[model samples]
Target: MFATAARNFVEEVDHGGWLIPVSSLNDTVNLLSVVVKRKRFWIWQRPKYLPTDFHLNDILTGDTPIQPVSIETDFIKYDGTYGENMKGSVNANVFDHSSFNVEGKDSSKLQSSFGSLKKEELDVQKLLRDSKNRLLDMSHGLVQQTMEKHRQVFGIVKERIVTTQPCSVIEEVQQGGNCGGRLSFCGGKSPKVSLKENGSLRKDSDVTMEIPIHTTIAYALIELEIKHDGRFELCLLSDTKGGFEVDGPASNQLLGASRAPMSPSESSHLKEELEQLGEHFQVLSALPATTRASLLQHITKVMENKEAVSSLQQVLEQMCQGKRPVLEEVTATESHKKSIQAVLDLLEQCGQTESAQANQSTAVLAALHLITSAIDEMTHECYAVFWMCCSFTGLQTLKKLVHCVSENGELPLSSSGLATPTEDVYEKTEHLFASCQVSLKRDGDTVKTEIHQQPGHRPLVLCIAIKGLASLDQSD
Candidate 1:
């Protein structure tokens, strides 16, 4: 191809296709372009070694130097006719004869540099592996923290559920022998039993159960919330924690102050009566004054309104089917009488007035009696919250209170004749309550839970909020 191009260039010099002036025979002639046969193209007589795809021999891409070599070129021309042809050969330099062996000719210095590059690549891989291992350790710590929080929360929930369950099984077994009516909420139907001459049941018997429930403190608060557009404000606390390990070392250090022993003045009330009840008193005392005051105010408001309470008390008397037997009246000052009366009023407000009316009232009645008895006792004696809850109010005591209320109504006289205030005897009574050791704050759609873990106190805070799309849907 090179020979043909050079021959054509010589033939076209007359037409001024490529012209150059040479002063001597040694002067160089350069051809920038040439025509070979019917095609025209630019050509370079020099050898070139451009970078290749590096896939060759698995070597990296680099500047490769190629050396040109000499080759024999043949030229043909017609002298006068086609039968007489003349041919000549000459030595020419071309790209066809060139050497490309970069690896073999490289200096020792270049080879050493390549070795250093390979060492750097290995070092980079080691760094990545170590970083991955460190990340794995951190991930395990995070997973443990998340799991511990869930376990603590669930432990609290499980405990509350168990403590709140009623001892209805024993009551059911005892009532089995007697034909007396028993209420079971587990099913839709009530068990049929032969009654022994009980009083007539009113057409509004269901409403009898309804009134007691409606008049309760819980029910009253729910109503006030709906009517006044109030918020769901509730707080439950425990000074005694359940058995569960906390999260981490840093968390422990941060929470060290919370684990300090309670102050003498703070826990002084518990010293008087160190039982389960003291737990409540501790929590009650820890609560903010505003919260405690608001709670007391609501309670007092419920007790003062006796209309609903009176109606439910009558329901209990009817359910009992006649005045119960009276027992020896316990002596009391007018002030003491009034205090007990207020306590009774509070009980009635909590639907305890009808505890004797139904058997299914276990959950309600058990909690009601526990609180009522604790309140009355705490006024005169110091009992631990634990013992207060564990020991039930004597069955005889319930009958005695019921009988007195039934015979002459509230503030009934003793068998010897005692004068008691009937109405307008309410006085301000400041009781104690406490707070939990958890912090909660709202941030748009999320509630961040933070707990300062205290010794013997496992604090749990629950925040329920409808946010974002949920709020929009609820609006409708």
Candidate 2:
């Protein structure tokens, strides 16, 4: 019989989809078959109770022990016959989760030299810094695109397009794919047909089919909720997120100014529209290439034509919605831990406006300032997230070194691997921990050791990497 082994079945939250794809599901089943060969015990479905961001690919490497999450992913022992090997496989860590201690784990290490090394608190802080920059860039990009769309909408100003005030009701594309209530006539015009010499329709008169009928919309509104302290959230008003409410007076005004009244729908001959269409056309020869778009928050509200953006009232009824997705957390690496205080500080600082503007109900100007100054005061305090306790390699090294020194009492300098390849490396970071020579001197109670860099005969990255790893690791 084969082992009842299966990689964790993580929930698919990286994308917004109704369900996981068939291809991905099939691949998972195939992979399970390959891993669990004969299958001693049975697992109903893949285990889905793991961490949201727990990626199995991050761990798998040759000869790495298959330690299961004791009660969670642990397979039941068929009998004591499978023996100690199978029993050891089910145990999670060198330090088990239930108890804070491990059987043969030691807790003593010299006080770590925490001078400048502590300031370089791992890659996560760097990742967070990059995220902050990306968000600000998105805001700037969205603003530019919205302004361009605003310019095009303004082009038809002279045609008396403001026929009615906007209803402010949420709507979508209608049955005929017409974007209801949208004022920009910039995309997909009415379909045209080609005619032949005898004034008859051409056989392939669908030449104008490619002309898009969908209205090209832009991101017009953003709701940035700046909560008490530094709890802040920013949402773009888009069709996918169902848009934000336009209830606040100032925010509501911003929404209304960005729209204009739509012409009432009528059933009339094509020639009937030709006369007024020409008049409207003459007015729009150039708003596309002129002035900078000012705040569109004061579009004239006309009441005479009182037919607000049609009676479409469309709603996407996704009553049985998919499960809510989770945000990926910035987890700590083995070398360093995150300071909760730093995250709180970011929430308080980056999540809020600087000063007086924070008190104002509609302080868009102040919120803009927060984006720049959010990561200003970064605390350089971090601890071991994977808890700097005894690891398998550490324990093995301690035992081996003790045994070596017990006889010789000292070794000048030698390769640490004991005439072998690096079998004890963390599979995820095997490449990062390059070759090194370690010298141990047994003086008093402690065996003083120094790890010296050894550039073996290999390609320098396919040349340079220890430098990169030093940059990556928070520990000096």
Candidate 3:
């Protein structure tokens, strides 16, 4: 019985040992401060179970585990008053710190590698900054050069002078017809009369005393004579009691002194008118040799009037009448004639008003100036003188001139309808002349230009001359 009991007890003990509770055993082990060492095969197979700081050599050597040492750094403060306290304090514990645990040679290599990377980065930044600065400077210089070139180009354009050729040749015949037609003529016949000794008239001698008829026929004849003679001389007066007569001594004196020197005012006025005329019409300078002589005579007679207004009106009238037909023929448009007529009507209106303002006179002059310019343009003449003259008057005057020219469709233009100088046409013909000569002479404010067309195979040799004067002084 004892043997059987002992056997049961042994069997139960063996079973209890195999069936021990895992939770109770784990708790007992934890409470007893026991070290549960994992098997070497298990540690090698399960890398996750190995300590983070464990090395293969430590495991191979089976060395005792090293305890981590906590390093503390001591910082000492030094006051300026104590020389000995000024010395810096370094902790020996810093050498054993984990951050400083790298091998001495490897630490130096790492520091050098990091320093090289930083230096390269700084050099790259400096190079990039320098390149950017250089690019900016180059751009600034280019911009300045471009601006200077544009300024020079603009200045050259502003100073450039544009010239154009005449639109058409205005024949002297046209000028003469137009000028002569403006004058009135009378159809009165001079009756033959004989004076009786007894102051009694016989039937054959019967005649009535009548006032001499005012006739433009004589004026036309005189103009024709002057044109032919190339010298201004008074027309022979008829001895008949009633005959065509001219203005007395004053008119005769002006005609007689036609070739004589002119006063400064007269010369200046004539120069200005000639310049204005010449600038517009190349033909004005190309007129027959006698034309200038005739013009000088006519101008002298017109200037005999003391009133500047009347004299100016007379000059305008002569130009309008003389150039109207030629302009109309050239343009094939009546706008030119209408424009001149409008100006004439305005001038007449101004004349009627005793209190006409200076501006009214200026306006009339502007219109006349514009009409003359249009006429010159239609004739293929330079019109810049008109613009120059009108510019001094007023902007409104220039606008008026443009308006009139535009209305007439006579504004100088190229075949493409672009505004161009008239000189373009003349330039083409310049090669046709053998010895075309252009000469300019300046005296004080007056400039005289002469163009001589040398005798060639052509039927006619042309010589044109013009005199221009500066604007009258405002003080004058």
Question: Top lDDT: which candidate number?
Answer: 3
Write the residue-wise lDDT of candidate 3 on 59-118 in tens digits: 111233322222222211111110000011122222222111111100000000000000
- Supply the global lDDT for candidate 2: 0.19
lDDT of 3 at 99: 18
Error of 3 at 333 (Å): 8.5
Worst ten in a row by lDDT for model 3: 105-114
TM-score of decoy 3: 0.18
Model 3 root mean square deviation, Cα atoms: 57.3
Q: Which stretches of candidate 3 lie above 4 Å from their native place? A: 1-257, 260-337, 345-356, 362-476
- Give residue 335's error in model 1 in angstroms: 6.4
Q: Report RMSD (Å) for each prediction in the order shown.
A: 48.1, 37.0, 57.3
- Looking at candidate 3, what is the lDDT of residue 151? 15
Q: CA lDDT of each candidate?
A: 0.21, 0.19, 0.23
Per-prediction TM-score to the true structure, in the order listed: 0.16, 0.14, 0.18
Better of 1 and 2 by lDDT: 1
What would the per-residue lDDT of candidate 1 be over residues 1-476, giving only the tens digit for each residue?
11112222233222212211111222121111110011001010001111112211121122342121222222222111001111112233234332221111100000000000000011223322332312112123322342343221111000000101111100000000111222223334855442232222111111001111111010000000000111111112323222223345533221111232332222222223233333333333333344334434332222221222222232222334344312123132232234434534443444444433443233222332323222222211111221121123222222222222223323233432433312221110000111222233323332232333331211110000001101111211
Residue-level lDDT of model 2, residues 22-79, one tens digit each, is 1111122211011111110101111111111212222222333322221112111111
Deviating ranges (above 4 Å) for candidate 1: 1-339, 345-357, 360-365, 369-435, 444-446, 454-476
Top model number, TM-score: 3
Cα lDDT for residue 136, candidate 1: 16
